[model samples]
Target: MKFVRTNKDRLVLISVAGEIAPARMRSPYSVTTEGKVKVIPVLGGITYNVRVGDSAYGWEGDHVEPGVSVMARKKEEEIPFMTLPCIGNEVIVMSGDAKGSRGVVTGKHGGVNHVIVHFDDEVLEKLMVGDKVLIKAWGQGMKLLDHPDVKVMNIDPDLFEKIGIVEKDGKLHVPVVAKVPAHLMGSGIGASSSASTDYDIMALDPREVGVEDLRLGDIVAIMDHDNSYGVGKYRKGMISIGIVVHSACVSAGHGPGVVVIMTGEESVLVPEVVERSNISDYLR
Candidate 1:
C-alpha cells in the first residue's frame, strides 16, 4: 500500500517535558468488575513488565497503563504536557539511569493527566518514577487538504502517514482493529477538551462486538462519535479514531482507554477493521 501524505511541513512542533509520575491508587480498595472492591495497580509511574501488544484484561489492576507515565511538575506545566504532545512524537529521557534513551508517546490519560510512553525493554528497566523526559511535540494543528471535516489531534504526522489510510470514493478509509459504537464509550466522554484525555470503551465482556480482540496500542474507530468540539458527543453519522492506551477496567462504565487522534463526519471518514491495526504492528 502507498503511504498517505499530508501537509506535515505546515505543522508547527513544540517542546514539552516532564518526569515519570509515581503510581497512585486513590484508595486502599477500589471498584472492580460488578462493584467488587480490591487493591491493585491503577496509573502513573514506570511499568517494568507490560508493553504494547499485551492483553488488556485479567490483571489484578484496573485501568492499567502500559510503559512509563510522565507528567509536568506544576498545574501550569501539566497543561502543556497533557495537551501538546501527540501520539508517535519522540520522547527523550533527560535524567536518571535511562538518560538519553529514546521513546515514543503512546497515550494520554485524562483523570490522571499522565502521558504514556513506550521505550525499549532495556530503557524500561532503567527508568525510575522521578526520571525526567522531553517530548518533541507536534501534530496538534494538522490538516488534511483533501478532507476538511476530518480533524487531526494528538498524533504525530509521521505516524499518521504510516497508518493504512486510503482515500476512496470521496471518503477516507481508515484501517482499524475495531469499530466501537458510541453507546459503549464511558469515562472521559465529557472532558473539557478531547486533546488532553482519552475516552474509555465500556467492555465488561472481552467478547464484546468489534473490539473483541482489543489490545494496547491498537488503533480503533468509534462510530457516531464527534470530537471536533469539546470532549465530543454522540452525533449520528460521525466517526472518531484513536489508539488503545490503557488496560481494561473492572469498574462500571470503564474499560480500555482510547486517546483521540482523528475525528470527522462519517460522510467523509470511514473505518475498516484490519488484522494489523496496532502501533506495535505498524511500527514493525
Candidate 2:
C-alpha cells in the first residue's frame, strides 16, 4: 500500500520474561449467567483443545485463554511483562521441556493481567507451569504516515504489513471479521491504556450480533470506540480494530476480550469484512 512511516529508525525494542501460569479459579464454583453455579477450567496453563483459529464460543470454560497464558514471576515485574510485549511479537521458551521452542504473542487480557501466546499443539504438550519464556517486544510506536488519522498500537511491524491495510482516498481500509457496536463493549472500559490490558465485548446473546462465530485472533471492528491518546473511550464517529484474545465468558461483564491494534475516525478507518481476518492467516 506504500504507507509512509513517521520515524522508522526510532522504534525501540524491549525484552521481558514471564512464566507459564498455572490454571486458577477464584473459588470452587463460579456463577453462570443462567443462574447456575459450576466449576469449569478457566485461565492459565497450556490449553490443548482451543487455539488461535478456533471458535471462541460454545466452551464449557469461562474466560478461557487460548494456547499458553503467561505472567511475570514476581509482582514487581508484572508491569513490564504485560505492557512491553505487543501482539504478534516473537516469544521463545527459555526453560522446561519446551525450551528453544518459538511462538507468537496473540494478545493480552485485563483484570487477571495475563499475556496469551499461540504455539503448536506439540509445543503446548511440552509446556508446564513455571516454565520461562522470553519475549522480543517491538511494536509500540508505529504510526501510518499516509493515514496519520488512523492510530496503530500493540502490533508488530511484520504482522502490520500483513494486515492487508489498503489506502485509497487518504483513508485506511482495514480488514475485519465483524463490526461490533459500542454498546456491546462491557468490561475494561476506563483503562488508562490499551497497550497492556484489553477490553471485553458483552455477548448477552451471541447470535444477536455477528460475533457468534468469532475465533481467537480474529480482527474485528469496534464502532464509536476511540483508543487515541491512550484511554479507551467512546467518541462519535470513531472506530477501532482489535484481535479477540480470549474465549467468550459466562460472566455478565466479560466476553471475548479484544486488544486494540488500530483506531481512527470512522470515515478514515474503514472496515472491509472478508472471509479471513484472523492473524493466523497472516502467519503459520
Candidate 3:
C-alpha cells in the first residue's frame, strides 16, 4: 500500500459552533409509526456518556445519542470539514477548555455534514461549542500495492493498518465488528458515493447481528454489497466495508449509519468477525 502525504502548512483547520439538537420533520407526514413526525437528533456537539460499541439504542427516537458530531461554518466551509478528514485521522482542539486535547476522526454523518470524532471521556467533558479543531488531512489518494481490484474509500493509510486487514490467498481479509446482510440495508443506498456519503442499516430487528452490538466507530461488513463510487447495488461475491457514523434511528429503513471505507468483489475481499472491532480499540 502507498500513501502520499499533503503539505502540512496547507492543512485545513475548521471551527464548530455547537451541537445540533433533535429536529422535527416539518411535514405532518408519517412513514412507519406516528404520534408525530419522525423526530430524532441529527448532528453536532459532544454525546456525553455514549461510547463506541454501545447499542445505538434503536426505537427510542427521543434519547439516542450521536457521539461527538462537529461541523464548520454553514454553506461552503462545511464542505471542507466534511470532505478533508478521513476515518482515523487525528483532530486537535485549538480553542476551548479542551484546547490541546487530541482525538481521532471516526466517521462522517452525511446530509448534516458532521464529522464524528472520538476522544477520551475526560476530553469529552471538556469539549464545548465553538471549539476550533485542526485536521491533519492526509488520506486522499491511497493505493494497494498488490491488489488493484479492491477499491479504497475514506480511510487513512495509517488507520487502515490498525483495522487488521490482511492479505491472504489473493484476497484482503478484513476484521469487522459484525457482518450485515444486504437485505437489511436501507436509506442512503444508491443515493451517494462511498467517498462522501453513508448508507443506513434498516434496524428492522434490534437483535440483529450488527444492530445491538454496533457502536459509533465500529467497522462492519455488508455482504453482497457493492458501492463502487456510491452506487450501491447487489452483486454476488461482493462485500463493502464501512464505519458506523451515527446512532440508530427509530424510523423504518433507518438505523446506525455506515460510511464506506473499502470494497471489493469475492476475488479481492473477505470479511472476518472480531469482537469489539471498534475504532476506539484500534486507536488505543
Candidate 4:
C-alpha cells in the first residue's frame, strides 16, 4: 500500500448520538416470510454481545447492529459519519460515563448512515446514547502509489496497515474471510460511489462461496465489482474490498451488507482466503 497526502481541512472531529430516536422500520407494515410484521432495534442503543457476521434476526432495513449503534447528531451530519470514518479508525469517547475511553470503527450501516464502534465490555457498560465520540477522520482521497488503477475509499491510513495486506506478484494481496462473486451483490449496486452506502451480499443460496459463512467485520472481496467513485457498478477486471457491516436480512436484494473499504481495477487487487479473517481478531 502507498500513501498520498490529503488536505488537512478534510479531517474533522464529529460528535455522536445527538438524539435517541426510537427504532424505525422501512415500511411499518412489512411482513417476513413467516407472515409476521417484524420490528427490531435499528439505532441509538447498545446492542449487547453481537459482533460482525451475526444474523440481523428478522429486522429489515439498514444500520442493524449486534453491538453499539452510534449515529451522527442528525440527518445532516450523516454524511460525515458514513463517509469519513473508515473501518478500524480510532474513536474516543468525548463525554458521558465512558469519557476518554477509546474504541474502533467496526462498520457502516447502509441507508441510515450509522457507524458501529466497538469498545471493551466494561466500557460499553458505561456508554450512553447522549455521550459524544470523536473520530480523527482522515481516509478520503488516498491512493496506492504502486497501483494507480486502484482507488481507496473510506479507509484510514493507519487502519489500512492493520488489515494485513501485502504486495506480491505486482498485485495487492488482501486477507479476507471469503471471496464473493459479483452476481450476489444486491442493493446499493450502481451507486456512483461507496463512500456513503454499501452493497448487499444476496446470499439466497447457502452453497455459494462465502455467503453462508460470512461474519460481521469479516473482510471480503467482491469479484468484478467496481466502486471507483462510491458507486458499486460491475465491470470486468475490477474488484472491491469491503467489511461485513450489518447482519443478514430476509428481504429481497438484501442480506448481509458489505461497506466498501478499498477498490481497484483488475491487476490491482487479489484476494486470499484465510479462515480466521475477521475485524474482531485484529481490533480486539
**RMSD after Cα superposition, model 2:** 1.5
Quote the positional error of residue 212 for candidate 3 in Å: 3.1
Per-candidate local distance difference test:
0.85, 0.86, 0.69, 0.71
Q: Point out the worst 10-residue segment of candidate 4 by lDDT.
A: 13-22
lDDT of 3 by residue, 105-212 (tens): 777777566777777889878877667777666565566657766777677667777767777666677888788989888878876556777778876565855467
**What ranking of all candidate models by TM-score puts the best one first?**
2, 1, 4, 3
Q: Tell me the spans in candidate 4 whose CA falls farther than 4 Å from its real position.
A: 1-22, 26-30, 33-36, 42-44, 53-63, 208-210
The C-alpha stretches of model 3 lying farther than 4 A from their native spots are 1-42, 58-66, 208-210
Q: What lDDT does model 3 reach? A: 0.69
For model 1, the stretches where C-alpha displacement exceeds 4 angstroms are 1-5
Q: Could you tell which candidate, 2 or 3, scores higher by TM-score?
A: 2
Residues 1-284 of candidate 4 have per-residue lDDT tens digits of 44333343454544433322234566655454455675554444676667654643334434466566677777787766677777777788888888888877777776666677777789989887667778656677766766667778766666676778887667788888777888888888876558877778876554555467677888888888788775668788888898888877655677787888788866758888888677776674
Candidate 1 residue 282 Cα shift, in angstroms, is 3.2
Candidate 2, residues 1-284, lDDT tens digits: the string is 55535444577887888989899888878788888898899878788888888898989998889899998889999888888888889999999998999999998986788999999988988988899999999878887777677778888888888878877777788889899999899889898888888999998888988789999889999999898765559888999899999999887988999999888897788899998889988864
lDDT for 255 in candidate 3 is 76
User: Each model's number of backbone clashes?
Assistant: 0, 0, 2, 11
**Best model per lDDT:** 2
